[model samples]
Target: MTIQLPTEIWWRILDYLPSNKVKQLGRVNRAFLEKARQSRYQSLVIYEYDKKTKRRLKKIRSSSLGHYVRSLTLCVQAWPASDLIRWDGQTGDSLSVVDRVRSLFDSHYLPRKTVALKKKRLDRRIELIFEAMTAFEHIQEYELIWEEYDQDCPEEFIPEVKFASSLMTIFLSMLVISPLRGTLTKLSLQIPTHIALDCLAAADFPFLEDLKVFLWKSQCSRAKDWDILTGYLGSENLAKFISGLSSTLQTLSISRLDPSINLDRDFGRVFDLLCRTNFPFLRSFDFCTRSRYLRKGTPSLDRFVRQISHSVRSLKLSHLAYDTSSSSPLHHLDHRSWISNVLSVQGLQTRAFSSLTSLRIKDGSLSAHLADLSALLTSVAHQLVSFFLEDNLLTLKEVETVVCSLSHSSSPLRYLGIEPRDLAPDTFDLLVCAFPGLRELSLSFERFTSSDDDVIPMTEEDVRCMFPNLCLDLGFFCFGLMNTAGATADGIICLRLRSAVSLEIELCLMR
Candidate 1:
């Protein structure tokens, strides 16, 4: 009297169970094992290349579970402490070239024997990672992360940048030539450097749709030396990579872009390439860069905004203003030359974001060029659906100006986010009345706090007072609160207001 169920029904039942439960069921019988493969192997993340990882890779390669793998995340740790220091110009140290790293200002903290052994171990780990990569056949999303490692010893400061460069090149080559190349649709590379970009230029993803590049702080600090280290720095490499995937790429986001030789000369080349080649499917474009000043009339930058004037639907621009006091040669350039060298939206009149519906502006607003910012706002005011402006706080007057511009839109905006200096008692009512069709609203309030209790409970009460009808939803609010006495951010409270309005209240501390 044994009951029989179809494999599909078993799979459906397995999907409802927790992952741990599914694994437990897998051990019950062969039928259950087959049904659980999808749950167990659908996504995998390898944080290290140790013996356990090696065993998992062996099992994957030996079984049919390889076909079930769709997403793979590989995090390559930074250089070891031994790799950081080198006793260069020392005779008969028995240091292998494979483990040889750039000298850390003539430091000899680690013994030569220790360096050699660690280098050998690192080589073995890298080999294991390469082997693990081959175990997946249908990987559709691959994320390669270069995790940051702390430099404990002051003497252990030098990095294996060159070795990392070569490793990335080989990794990219393996990825593009593998069976998963055609299946891959999303690729996120967390290794931020000119070398990474150069490696990217050498490969192509046939079906890639989403690409995200994050610039690490460590990498950002060394941007000035990238040209000398990598032996080349230019936007051409990035442009070439984009051109290769122009047809299939749908989303492109480059964050924390540091101004360097590669970013300075033809900073707009990457943007301009996206336009010239014409990414028909491109819908979202996000670019954030740190600059000392706005370059008013740079042709490359001007042409870029104009070229993509009609295609992008989501645009996010973050201009992190660098301290003008910093002594960069570009800062000393004459007014005219400065005007000719940087990207400026001072006279943007063509409705550059004509097709845009969602816009996010953070860190530095184009407030300095009021006329241009106003003009730009007016042009896109008619069609914007969601808008978020934060980091750079806006005055009440500026907030009113923004609302006035957006109020004219034919279609009501569904979402609005802003940080205002002072919140009047009637601010909530004013916003609710202004955007009748708004479904979600986000506001940031700054307050000085001496303790967590002072920040949390009082802020919640303040929120309740501001939007009394939304207090019930505050019960389930996920608050990211800071407990420090003098923390800048107190907490965030999410609330549901009325029938459709969703509110996100952020509590920040004033400096």
Candidate 2:
């Protein structure tokens, strides 16, 4: 007798099985085949295109398997000469991609014969990508990553193909017009230059919920020299595009690797516009810049933060700080007021960020003003479940101030990560007791003493006293298992510390 399970039961059981085991069960019946199709076709990532991939995509397009795909990631890397060989002998749909590509180039008056041989090759790959994308119908998430070797590549290596900025813009414009656009909810574009942003500003993403734009250079572009990129900073286009999506967008993350653009003038304008727009559904907003000083847009930044404070659950403001040393003494006198101007709203200091639970403040000169930092932390302590202050190492006294500020909160925090300029024996006890419900803790100390061996003697006894079962491994001590189940079992504790050269400790516990 054979066991017969309901379809839902079979689905639940298959979800728990590994891919290889699921494949074995897939051959049993049509139901198993359906589950296997979903498991295999739901997410697809193609790094490079070739004869094999072309053939596989053709099969998927002609069958029902394409409909099962919900996510796709296509990495466009520097095309090797072999991958872009002319389609001289191929026929049928191969010729169609060539014709469509040639027509697109012709529209710009870029005659295929006059263009560089490598460019013509690049054109073929771009067209092939377009054709390959038509296979999926229900894609809800799509990531288009332009992967190129940087200047750090070995001198012996030579990049054969060089693509123009306009080509990328054209490709992106066409990509958004696909049939799957209406169904897309998450979109990530990793491209180079503000030209792409300008081109995509007009495209509509009615259902888009999450948008991430990462601007960097491709292999064809030179490194550290952003002067090659033409066109204005697309601030107006970006503001317009984001405003259009405000009704449905829930998460927005924007990052730029190019450091030449002035944050005060470019990003400040963007934030100034964002301050006025209302995002009823927005829950997370992350903006990162490489600027060392934020001289302008303090008022706009404060308003923007306060505008979303009530709705956003996770907030990150990275590398946004003023440089006191760069300013004259007269201007330096206003440092505390400046920090307040950027952090708090006009009349809602305590009520700001009422819904925010996760906050990350990273890489800046914020530690210079201890009082303002303490006040900001104290105000949000009761609501934040995960708070991380990275790259801003506080002194031992400053760390005590932070702990004391957060100690007033009634809610228990689950994760806390911070760095201290120095570490004392009592530091561990202070942190562990400060947040009794902390499940994970990260502490990095810049120095233990003048000598490197000072760290071992400082932490060894304290760690041993706290958890005797911690096993020593390669100068670091660890206790309990690393998995979540083991973390909850037997009230186990895991602690690891390094030497004074760079003393670091990571501890995790339950209850």
Candidate 3:
């Protein structure tokens, strides 16, 4: 080990080099591999197969770059039963008596799991995935994607492995976590509540900081088979399942079409976990549910929001409420007000929205109304200076409340977006008049009436009179961009008014 090239300059040089060049440098020698490890083998996508994966594993294991992999994605998909026989020829001769015995034990002891294919294929795939994944020892993030829906399904199915095959991805998900426990910092996995809860309870990720779990199709699972995840798995079990990540997880996003139809208790359990667990460093919590506001659950959810309001910095919730009283698709807006009230809780006067800086609510059948919204802005305008609201702004009365309530508050809002139905010249004028200190505003006027009452337009001076410190966007205005020098509030505003009776103002807020 005599003199060599300076190691400190390698990073700077690698910055300008492409990926192929980095791989090229990694193969140069032991020194080059060690120095270029970070950029050489940064990401890897593994498909579940024997030969391809075996070859890759062999290459990475023999090379020094295998220790440098930081992110690994395992996309486990099902193969037809025909493919299962192809492995028989190879495995029949290769599998030892102990190996066969271990496979039997895996089926018996591995959480009663399933894959998307026959048990034989599922078992083989799981074994192959585990074997390949164990080679990458330095991975920090792991993602497991099941391709059940992406490929053709077996029309004739056996109940046993069909369910197990579906769960093979989850089983592999647990296995993926085991190898990376000491080094993993992020895990984005898709495991059913029943499986994940059990697997995670026993597993520990010392350095794991982020965990994203996608709650899969519970309705179909419940409808078709007596599956463990849906048939017997309840929210309490699900909560206990996720609690394993409480100490380490700082960011979480669990998205679904809406699992509450089958697992309402699971949704409740999430809030319960939040209430009981004190994750001091947890900065963001993102959750989505499709069920309407059933009784008991809303109150607990409200309480959860109240607790996390002062802690979590960013929150995004969707499809959160539904009409508990009526079964109609149309939601009576009043029911959603409670959620809004809890989220923007404060005193009577305008102030800063303390913990939350950005919030995007998408409930197709809801809005906070002009009055409650004004209160929310009055309370949070100082700190929550920016917000986007989609509402059917049809009444002047509501517009007046916004102006009267928050206009004089110390925490005047700096940014606001409102989509109103039945656009009126006077109401639009009054809305601008309300936010005297507004720096930026976006207004969309839909369902435009050609009648004289609705068609009243405002001149530039009229606009200026209404929005004192603001400039109108004036799409395709009289002059070019340079001519609009006097624009205020981020330079311009847009009045997107459309004429039509068919369009209804649908405010997609968290239901």
Candidate 4:
């Protein structure tokens, strides 16, 4: 007798089984094995530490698991000696402990773990990890996280290691050599600049639609190396890379470049390359930096904005504060103005983005520049559905002006986020009125003051008075007074109206 079931039912049952278990069931018979092989698994996670209890994973020949995988996360834990301090006066030698761990890792024959380095050995360890990653044939998304190790007096035996930086270079090298380019949809290189450039030059991910490159502060101090780094990312090379990318690449994010390094010429060249390139599918753009403005005017910023004006649908601008001194009022204002000018110009462009639906501005104020920003918002508000402004300096009145501009338009905007100071009563009402289709709203209120009668009851009259168009998804956080009756009730009604809408209410009670 044989068990006969519908194919759909079998697939549904198989979905309930773990990958390892599915593999086990596959070995039970040929039918099970074929079904298991056909299953489309979406995520693959490879960790540095081996599980204490090891179970045998099915070894299938000639079958690549890459096609089914959508996302990949790699976590590498470098030995931390300081974490192993004993309560007694006697302290464990950090290097000796690391050596013991390395020895145990060496015992394993796994490809990624095969290259276990001796204590204080950095280069060899990185090599081994790269060798192991070569087996992954198709990878759509990749994440690399390297833990830092402490350098205490007792741990002097451990070499002053830049392990993360070295590891990044090796990973980039693998991307160049790997045949996974065509299938690679998203590539995130969280490494230093040199390695990122090297990887960019090595392979062309024709299907690469999204790219995020993170450059950390490198201790390497040679003018020649810096020149080489920039040289690799020159206009010609960038053009070649984009051209080879099957014309599918869209979103690009570069982080943490040296602030002192003048980005005007380089960014201009990049903008030219992108403008010349045909990105029919490009829709979103994000530019973030920790560097300060070396020159007074932000030509690079303006040029970059102009280049992408026609295509960008979703945009995010973030500036990282390097130090307290670097956070001077003048410098901060300069950065804000540069960003504002770009937004204003882009908004005014005749060939505006028709597909833009979402916009986010972070860590800077858009108030002083709201008039310019309002022009941009008015241009795209018709198609815009979500807008987020976090940690920006804006007064209640300014926020209302922008919201009023957006509301007047016949746009589909349903979600709005603003900083704490911008959430005044009048401004809140204005936002609710403007985005009639609004399903989600987030407010960061700096101070919420109320007189003696804080918790006022809401009648039908009040509801109509507050919001004539009552349908919305409300998320509110008040930094001052917690007692606001109608606010909470209105929030509940908004949540109940739309199943898709999410509401969050936080009241900061006054002391």
Candidate 5:
């Protein structure tokens, strides 16, 4: 007896199987193999070190499987130092394996697929791969990842050395070739800081609509080298890079290796470059730091705030703090001036976040720059609809002021998240009154015991009387509750009574 299954069911089952297993199933029988080789399995990955596997992949690329593959990733392991010195010699065992792997990609069997090439060797292999990929007529997305080598390596006897050197050369070649620029809409490139500066200064990606660049800093070096490297990434280079991009870019994210580097004047230059560029279609911008340094003469937070306030619709500020130093004056007039500039009334109007709807401020406790932040928020309260102040040092008065200000705004705010440390009973009551139309609320509070008299004395009846038509999120407060009742006009109250008081209560009393 033969059993017939629906096509949809068969595809669904195949979806759960691993790619290697799916490839095996395709080799099971002609009928099963044909269906398995469909476009549903379009993504392919070829590794250079895996000789037997890549050779088989090459065969598949030439067969019917080639027509179905839409996305391909090429990962070649970095050849060890021993392999580098032996390159001039006759074809060794490792070199032969590398050749076999390179042949598969060089064949150009699946030219239409999106290609991701990760290089472990910096040599001719990379150039060959790019040359082959360029032949494809319908490639759309391309990504390149290379191991960053900044310091001179000590002598080693490891195999695959030649491959590693080759990989580096491949990465350098990409900067000049610019093959993936015009066709790619979304591009992510992980480049060394030195090469990143070079690419920023020289290359232009006209058709790139979304770009994510991770610039890894070189190994710590002398001050002169740092200056030279940073000077290459000055405002001019930044402007050139942005100018080269298509005016249709919708999202831009610029990040630095060290949060301390973000405070450098070069960061301000990059910001200026972005502003000068024509990104009229841009809707989202994110600039973040991994940590903060309070070095003297560093660009203040106000400069960054001013740069992004106009065009960014969603903003996130994280890991802010002043670098500790005994030599540098902790309380300088310039520091005060910077703070004043960030909170300046004139700057607020000039860079009013008129388009801003979502704002997230994290790690404010370490930074003593709350005054400027308040001023900034006060300026843009008219347009904000979703505000999140997480893990910040906000007093009850400041919390009440911000909430009241937002309530007075004509904008329709639907979501609000405030830490519990910033709230008192009076402030909490003020929040409900100010944002009557709130749909979601998250509050984080300190430890609360059952015996504590200062607990929010909110009964089910009180909740029903207060928020008759709204959803209540009491999860963050850790308020212990027993009987929570929900009532309707019919006079019957649906009481959800928890038998015992637990550590936390998440009550949604629907009326």
Candidate 6:
């Protein structure tokens, strides 16, 4: 007897399988071939040949899987040997770009001479990706990454290794699609060096809704040219590109590799451009790079935030601090700039941060600026649903004040993160009592529990009894009911389910 299953059921079962396992199902039968291929091709990652990463996508170009792909990420290898005399200006050679790149892969190297491969084998890998991309359609997200390389490479990290100009020239001349793609809704790219899009500048991405860029700063060595490079990034072309996305973009995260990049002066033009555009649905923003610092009282970051403040629900200014020793013309910055800028905007006639709900302040403690932080919290407490204050700076009273505010006036804060040292046993109990509606609580316990009395009053059983759905994360063990809580975390993630929590999400039902 033969059993017939609905095609949807077959695909449903295949969805739970591992990607590699799903790929194997393509050979099981004709029914699985289509479903398995679709599942396998939904997301594709192509690691450049020069990377230490294993390459599994060499055959993707010839395959019909391109049509099924929705997410595509390419690690564009840096010209490892750009500085090498042998590799200089070879992109112009009559040799086909693919053939030229293949030669580097074929070359036998000598151990004594570390020629950054003179960017030897990188071209062919890039050539293959560009070739593969042309076949891609209906791709919803695109990412171009130039992975970081250790100092061992001949490339100088002080002045970031750049994508070779020759290769860029050729690629720009022939390259298709903007990093901000019209066909895709999400685009993320790392701008390690100053480069422009002569070919892609004109392309408008009506569908693009999210754009993340790592706007790296020019190395200190180029102090003289720093202004020029940064100014170039905020050129008319880039402004036009961002303006085009105003309608569709909902999330924007501009991170940094060089924290010192002055957002006010360097990123001013971009912010000016963004203010002119309106992102109706924009809701999440993150600038959590640990090293990023601000230079001005009303920095570009502040102005930019105000533009979308009305619509954004999640805002992360983690590691955003005043650069006391900032080299820009202005050396001393008021540390209170970040808080003051966001709060002062309420006086604006255009919009207030009416929809803001989540605020994450990593590496910042409220104790230093309790008054400023408190006032800022009060402004948005009614809308906030989650709050994370890492690097515990708030005293028990302060934490209590914030929690009490959330409990009484605004919606309950579902997520809370704090260090154990800041909250004594009694204080913790009070805080917990103040906010019983918490969905996740993160507590940092390092050396504090050395004394028996310093230990938290609650146990796995005690916590489980309070929040039945809570996922508790103990330092040593993470579980629900018993000592079931999982492995050690420099910090803990409270998993409020299963009467217990485990170290790895894979070990528990969370997976």
For all candidates in order, the CA lDDT equals 0.62, 0.63, 0.54, 0.55, 0.50, 0.56
Compare candidates 3 and 5 on TM-score and give the better one. 3
Worst 10 residues of 3 by lDDT: 501-510
Higher lDDT: candidate 1 or 6?
1
Best by TM-score: 2
Model 2 lDDT-worst window of ten: 480-489
Residue pair clashes in candidate 4: 206-245, 407-434, 420-444, 420-446, 439-473
Residue 479 in candidate 2, Cα distance off native in Å: 15
Model 6: what TM-score? 0.71
Instruction: Please provide TM-scores, in order, for all candidate models, with all chains considered together.
Output: 0.71, 0.72, 0.62, 0.68, 0.61, 0.71
Model 4: worst 10 consecutive residues (lDDT sum) = 52-61
When 1 and 2 are scored with lDDT, the better candidate is 2
Each prediction's RMSD over C-alphas, in Å, is 8.4, 9.2, 10.0, 8.3, 11.5, 8.5
What are the per-residue Cα lDDT tens digits for candidate 4 across 357-461? 888876454565677778777877778888887656456567767776676557688777765452344554566567656666666554443322443333334
Model 2 agreement with the true structure over 87-172: per-residue lDDT tens digits = 43332113345556787757743344335544555576677677757767788999888666544533323333333344466567
> What's the ranking of the predictions by lDDT, best on top?
2, 1, 6, 4, 3, 5
**Candidate 1's residue-wise lDDT over 18-119, tens digit each?**
887877876776777767887788889987555677788889888767888889987754544443322232332345554445334345634655567546
> Which runs in model 1 stand beyond 4 Å of their true positions?
1-22, 25-39, 81-126, 150-163, 194-199, 217-234, 259-262, 272-275, 291-298, 320-352, 447-472, 475-501
- Candidate 6, residues 1-511, lDDT tens digits: the string is 3345688898779867877688788776777777887788778776534322223343454555567888887654443434332223343222445655666776643321224443453466455556556667667887766554543444353222443433444443443453325488888866554556554556577777787877544322245646545444534555667677778878878665554444455456666777787778888887644243432433555677877777899887655444424463222233544544554554343436678788876544334555555556666766677777665445456667656655553355677665543323454466557666666666653322211322333456765655554665553332222221222224333433343222111111121
What is the TM-score of candidate 1? 0.71
Q: Candidate 2, clashing residue pairs?
A: none
CA error at residue 167 for candidate 3, angstroms: 4.9
